[model samples]
Target: MIYNIYFDEANKIDQPGKANSYYGAYGGSEQTMTDITQTIQRMYEELGTKSELHFREYNHDQHLKKYFKVLHYIINQDVNINILIVNNTEAHSIAEQLNLTMMELRNLFYIKIPERLFYGVTRHLHGQLDVNIQIDRNDEYDALGLHSKIKEQMNAHSVYRSKRYKIASVVSEESHESIPLQIIDTFMGIVVFLMEQSYMADSNTTLIKSDLVYRFLSEGGNVERFIKQIKLYSWNGNENLSELSVGNYISQFMVYKARYDVSEIAKLQAIMLKNPGLLAKEYRNLMEYPNTLTRMLLGYKDEVEGRGRNYLLFQ
Candidate 1:
């Protein structure tokens, strides 16, 4: 089977700052991907889907129903959704500690996001699956020969050593013309807005955006399932990968998950081994709030791994 992946990013990852950055990939079989575009067109006629599908242009009063229809359809399809969230402050600090130029570190992430998105989607399949990627037009990636450079690296991934998947082509297209790009762009905006907690601010725009997000997740357990498909996480330089790799050092990514203090983790582990039943009943009874450094992981079903207790109160 052949796959066509559309890529988009939110936030400036290269620039040094405290804010979080995000990159997203969304696509699937060529037929499925095309069907999504056509499906939205039909919805446009029936439900009056907005002509401008970009999330930044969203108006709660006019676009909520239309956007929700698109969002609902996208989530239900058997497509791959992968997002990379990066902590900009941590990245710059890592660059300083490793004595690498800011440009050098930025170059690494520019490649890793697409590489991981490709891997995250195609890793499970074992066959000669032809993969093509189209990135939304952006300044950061708008350089001659960059597309070929990315294509070469993706085709060289170790996961594809068994001839599992081959990168066919990498191209850039305008988001306005590309339905796939616009779709991922909206999803990217949602993830970034939520992670930044901008919704907590008492602003008219924030309130509208919050309402849209809350409505998307209004159904029971819908949040967990929706979040899972996206695989939204980060590479914050927590662990070093400088010496482990052959070429330049790349920051290892840690997926989004809850985080408790060391003492709390140990205590929870003890409980798991002693009385597994009690662990469930009192797992929410955290002694102190979860560590604020990482803001904890979200949508955890259980504490079997002792990875954490409060998933940043995501529940």
Candidate 2:
């Protein structure tokens, strides 16, 4: 079988002190690509939107339904997603400890992060599949240069050392021209957002963000069941990368309910009465407020409807 991997990055690429950086690669067979594109086209038609589906551009409550549908389509399809998360502050500390230059650190990140993510995906192939990787075009690295670096790393890895597994090509392409790249871009957005929320010390923000992600996935199918099909790999300036299960993350978040201030609870009640969708909008608004109560209320509603936990404590 021929497998194509589409790659993209989220957040500042070379900046050292930033909180988070993510590189994601998602792809499947050619047939799966066709199926995904067709489904996305149908969604656009239904929504009367002719514009391309870019996660950053369309992240809002009004577009939440379509976003959920797109996610559902990707999850139900044969595509695989792998994300490499970098804690830049930690990475910088490690670089300084190792006496590495900023350029050396950046190059290491660009090369190793994607290489590890790709290795994780390719290692499972067992030399049975031919792979072609296409990365989204970026000014930071030339196409030929990146292709060479990736090819060299793949060759060094034990997983691709077999004669039977052939890397057909590794090239960069304009994201606007490829549906799979766009799809991966959208997925990366969610991945980055969820990772950021995972680090938040505020229990309410963490719980709300987790529930929002759960609801988004639940729209397509059973979130628990669907999570088994996806893989998440996290790196935080450690010698080894760790794997996280979406199901377990959701379960952990669901069990914890932080006490909300009485005034905040009242605000949430008023917001729910006026427009429940507004809560979703607020969740998407990364700029202004934490809006932890909105997520708590949503989780409570889900519990009441028997879609999630059986009981949630407001206090």
Candidate 3:
């Protein structure tokens, strides 16, 4: 069967920081992709929109229902997404200590990240898995000449190595032309944002973006399923790449509770929608806000429904 792979990257591609760079390839079988693309195309056509669908272009006022349906459709489909996180902050120091140039280290990642992503998806299946790849082009990979290396590396792995995934072709395409690319592009943006911005010490996210994020989390059970499809591959400089250390392991993406804290997110939005006036004009100790608000919301819930839903806290 033919597998369609749409590749996209998010975060600071070559920058140094926590959750800095992410390389992702997301898609499913050709038939699956075609049906999804046509469905999304009809959504846009129904709204008289002649533009690309992207998380970056997400607007709470304009595109809420559109994006909601998009996410809903994606969750109900069979898809796989793998993201490799390069903690350049750790990698830079690791490279420096090992006396290796960043270029050399980056070259290995270019070859291995996508290789690992392919391994992740194809490991379970068997027989002739012909893969077609379309990448959302970026300058960082462009400098590395990844255009050719991507196909070369994947085919080389499948041809000689026991890797079962084979690449038929790799091409660069605009998200506007392909709905699957746009879908990958959207979720790729979300994964990177949740990892990078929430981890930033002093970052204050825009309310509109957070609104979209809350809506993204509004998927409920689908959120967990969506999270499962995205796995993060990491090689923080803690491991010696030259030594090829056995201690190294690539894991899936994880986020702290502040943003992905779905319970608090739901409560906050519910409160904001129900009665914005009950909120304080200013708080002296902002650190005390969550607990204080939780108490208030619980009290309000009890008053309205005649019982406290303390059980939801465990979930």
Candidate 4:
């Protein structure tokens, strides 16, 4: 069977001190692309707007209602969805160990996360299945590099080498021109939003509730099942970094950034001891609120650090 995988990404990959999370989701099936495209086109016509459907633009009540309907329809399809969410702190620690620059780390993740997602999607298949991967084009890197990386990873895998699965091609296209890509984009937006909420809740940041998201979560079992299929991965340093306190990790990361004066790291370290989440948020307004860092430190103090493994198949 020839399966077409449409992929899209959300959130920044290499933000050093940002609280935002990263996600990539890809969905695949033989006929799902065509079916979703026609349904979305019909939705556009019915809504009396020629604009493309983007989840980020779902702000107004009318748009949210329409988007919820669209999501319901798409979630009911037979396509398989796989998602990857990165643990930024652990990823940063790994990048530091490897001496990778921000851009290099970004490129590595661009390849690694998606490759992991693809592997999870096809790991159980024991028959011939030709997979064609289509990613939304982004100028951060060229299509050739991504294509090469994906091919390399796929060929290196034992299952693929056994001839049960074949990578037909890895190509990039404009999201606006690909209906399947748009559907994946919408799905990723929902996933990213939920992740952000979880991050904020961990950080003790104020949570913003979305009725649309709640509706999807409550509508039926499929969306919840789809979410359970998401796989999260992170590169731990030589040791299990999650076992370390947020303060300890920050101090270590600061040592790596020794180019910055000692006073700055000291000041940040002191603040982290008191208010850890503040360290995760970008230095902007002087707002001091607990965030992920706080949770990490508390976890350390309770001797329950690393309670949750970073990479797991969502249950």
Candidate 5:
């Protein structure tokens, strides 16, 4: 039987401060890599239907072709196996290069592995939004089936939870007043915009824009009015103010005035999520918090630090 597996490349070796070989470069503790891998594996087994099927994992340390070799050994004859590769990055050029490199591997494997036994999966992973779907290459059945399956799986999986407002921490003795309605409205608009841009990009695409939008709202100010002011001076005069389009403009602004402290907190959370080793330490910090902001920020920080840090580092 040709086993179809989804392939995603992650930098498992820790080097938090070193530059990424691909995507935006940065360096951090190897802890981040370990955490993400565990999360994915646990999530897959806990969430995926065919949990027992080996995922055929690989990382930057190994060349793409080396992975194909393992597949060749598994499939010698008329068995059919399909695998999809995933990564985090938005630049199409990067994805294309990875694909080309994979093709080179296939060529090498053709002599070693049966061509009939190995065919690329019809779909791949998106970098930014982390959405998975089959590529729409005019193949109706595969496209439809894959899209439906991915959607179904995501809806069913509770690997992570989402919340509306991000809170840092609250005192048990007192309640922090909710953010102004105007600010929340503006912040939500930015999220809608950022998420839109992210959806249009690759699955590995970092949610940098979303983070920026969140930060913009997080700062104390007349949120909507400030956004409107930013829009007025922006090139298109509010025409590009949707979540995705606005991200483009605001991203530049963030470069000039982004807060590292908040971003650092976000990064810390990302690290905790990926590295279960750090979870205990981080969870303890979180448990001490009396409010949702602390919990949410901690969670958000882990993801940002692990996956989104590079993007937010300078900005």
Candidate 6:
């Protein structure tokens, strides 16, 4: 679906008695979702430059809001669109805000909002003109003016339980890339932070090789940065590829190659298989981290190959 909304309910800040106490019942989509895959590739290239390194500490809230706005802008501008809402228990109010008939909205998208608002907001937002107003839940604001049916649904819940709504779903759907982009963004942030603070190195040696390889595979296995970063790091006569931790460098490269379809990624994978010594002991030791995206990359490559896409990876 063009619109894949994640709506959270009872996320109110001060409402400990209510649902979603800390996060505040927020529902929204990111603009980048439509182009997330491409954006990840672009981010891969942009991370190569020192000037773009600040993305390490980039503000997540601001980026998410910006994407949300972008998505809304697109929906308002495009006609005959499809949308899905991941239903949240408390946000029947949003249904009233979007102006889509409940059935029409559900048919085009997946709804996950709490079921209480399902029918109420469905009726409220339908045929409404003001689609951009911000909504809030508090003593003075009862913005939704929800229908009795919704109220009855909420009352049906246990005293300690909150209400829920299930937005409808359509048989046909358009997949977007927001989730993938967010994943890539998170990794890029870590890479940038490591590089910016020089934590990328163990002692004297820098992470230039790993970072460069990260950028290379991030761009779908392009080897241009691989050559450039190696050359740059080796500028001093004493430094060379052999001096860097083989395991770390290879792991970094595998991460990028796993995400994209590149020509020689399999060749590079083969290199890792034939010469495990290319990565140093200490580098391999870091695999102790809780989640290994590098492993995921390997898995992704396997899946791609299974789909009959020309692929290669060292065992």
Worst 10 residues of 4 by lDDT: 306-315
Model 3 lDDT tens row, 39-139: 88887787667767677665333454567667777867898877777777776777788898877877766766776666565566567888888877666
Using lDDT as the measure, name the better of candidate 5 and candidate 6. Answer: 6
- Who wins the TM-score comparison? 2
Over 201-280, each residue of candidate 1 has an lDDT whose tens digit, in order, gives 75546545554555455434545556556765466776422211211110111111112124445665565566666533
TM-score of 1: 0.70
The CA lDDT at 54 in model 5 is 18
In model 5, how many backbone clashes occur?
43
Arranged by TM-score with the best first, the candidates are 2, 1, 3, 4, 6, 5
Ten-residue segment with the worst summed lDDT in candidate 2? 253-262
Better candidate by TM-score, 3 or 6 = 3
Counted clashes in each candidate structure: 2, 0, 1, 2, 43, 31
Pairing residues by index, what is the TM-score of model 2?
Answer: 0.72
- Candidate 2 C-alpha lDDT tens digits along 23-117: 88886886778778887888879887766557666423334446556776677776678877777777778888999986777777777777888
Off by over 4 Å in 5: 1-212, 215-253, 256-258, 261-263, 266-290, 294-301, 309-315
TM-score of each candidate structure, all chains considered together: 0.70, 0.72, 0.69, 0.65, 0.18, 0.20
Off by over 4 Å in 4: 158-163, 198-209, 222-315
Query: What's the residue-level lDDT of 25 in candidate 5?
Result: 10
lDDT of 5 by residue, 1-315 (tens): 111212111121122431211100111122433343344344435433222221111112112122222222222222111211111232223436567553343233222211111111212221122322212122322333433444443433323333111111111111012111112122323333432333234221123333333443433443433343221111111222122133354555455334534665655555565565655345546434223233234435544546442222212
Query: Which of the numbered candidates is closest to the native, going by highest lDDT?
Result: 2
Greater-lDDT candidate between 4 and 6: 4
**Residues 1-315, candidate 4, lDDT per residue (tens digit)?**
877777676767566565544445555566666777788788778767665567776544334446666777777776666655556776677778889986788887777767766776777666787788888887764833887788678857835457577788888899778877777777767656554443234222211124345444445674455544444433343332122122232233234323322343345455556665643344212223234233223222222223331111111
Q: After superposition, how far is residue 127 of candidate 1 from its true place, in Å?
A: 2.3
Worst 10 residues of 5 by lDDT: 20-29
